[model samples]
Target: MEGVVVRRVIPSDNSCLFNAVGYVMEHNKDKAPELRQVIAAAVASDPTKYNEAFLGKRNEEYCSWIMDPEKWGGAIELSILSEYYGREIAAYDIQTTRCDLYGQEKKYNERVMLIYDGLHYDALAMTPVESAPEEFDQTIFPVDYKRSIGPAEELALNMAKDAHRKRSYTDTSNFTLRCGVCQIGVIGQKEAVEHAQATGHVNFQEYR
Candidate 1:
């Protein structure tokens, strides 16, 4: 696998981070108790402050565990708090350290890497934007139509209208939406809005 650039966890990175945590919990059943404790401690801390610090520092000391398989047992969990569409959202998750354990000739590390990979793939599938369509018409008006608003404002207005439509119609309420490529359930307008905010698509005009 190619090396992944594990960027600093800004507040906007929470959803992905949380998805990573869920991936670990679901797939890494054999993770060490001590390791789990460390992850839990990090999650239990103030997410806003911790995420800010993590992003601000962007240093090895702050992110070494995420890159070192031996230190945090190939996985590290963290939280990101971000504001999207004027709403605060939290995302947390455990990420596998990118290392070639088999190449390193460490049997234990190799096993851990396999387990981590399983979780990572599963979590990726579960991400809210994993299955989102890309070609949906987001423009509410025709190109030739006269408009007084910018693209961002138009998008917000469209989102509000879609929210109202979803809230009013039961059949539409059951529809699923995607953020990027991730599929998300639409329980109602509020949930849809939350999902949009969480996935950094707050001003997206696409109905689904």
Candidate 2:
């Protein structure tokens, strides 16, 4: 009896990365705040390693920014969390159909999967059946299990291709957005950033 690999959708609350990671690690989706703190604390503890140059901001500023619930997490946060958890974190990107392995150099004995569809993150799991619930999901995979791991990777690739075909990703460079604060329409990332800076309005909603 073989299991099916599937992507478990996480909420779009700007904390999808943390939630996806938490779900795969602990079967808990509500650990965003705690995980955010973990990254902040790790950065604060090693100012020399995560310096202003490396972080694109002051260490204290990065720490403060990460603690904000509205802030999104990315590569730096993934790297920090990977070291914190002592496992390889593989993010399968739908746009590129590439799996970016964080902590791969450390040769971690275990690995976890996440689906990254350009703007959002989702957890990847293997279950007994296609429609099995999260409770029956096996999110963690031992690095040595090539036979099983191959299926998971294949599944992720196929999912990514499907998402690509459906145009299910946001091209930040050329997307329409409406300011949630004032309802002003903006085009693309450049206008959005300018609008935010000028109006101090950070909330934005994308539309087709």
Q: Identify the candidate with maximal lDDT.
A: 2
Tens digits of per-residue lDDT, candidate 2, 1-208, equal 2688888989999999999999999999999999999999999999999999999899999999999999889999999889999998999887777888899888888889998877799998989999887889998887773423566767767888888888777777889999999999998989998998899898999987
Candidate 1, residues 1-208, lDDT tens digits: the string is 1111121111222133333333223332233343434553454454655563644433333544343332222223421211111111111121212222121111111011111221121121111132333222121111222322134233333433443444432232344444444654355446766876577554322254
Candidate 1: RMSD to truth: 19.8
Model 2 TM-score on a 0 to 1 scale: 0.93
Candidate models: Cα lDDT each: 0.30, 0.88
Best by TM-score: 2
Error of 2 at 167 (Å): 1.5
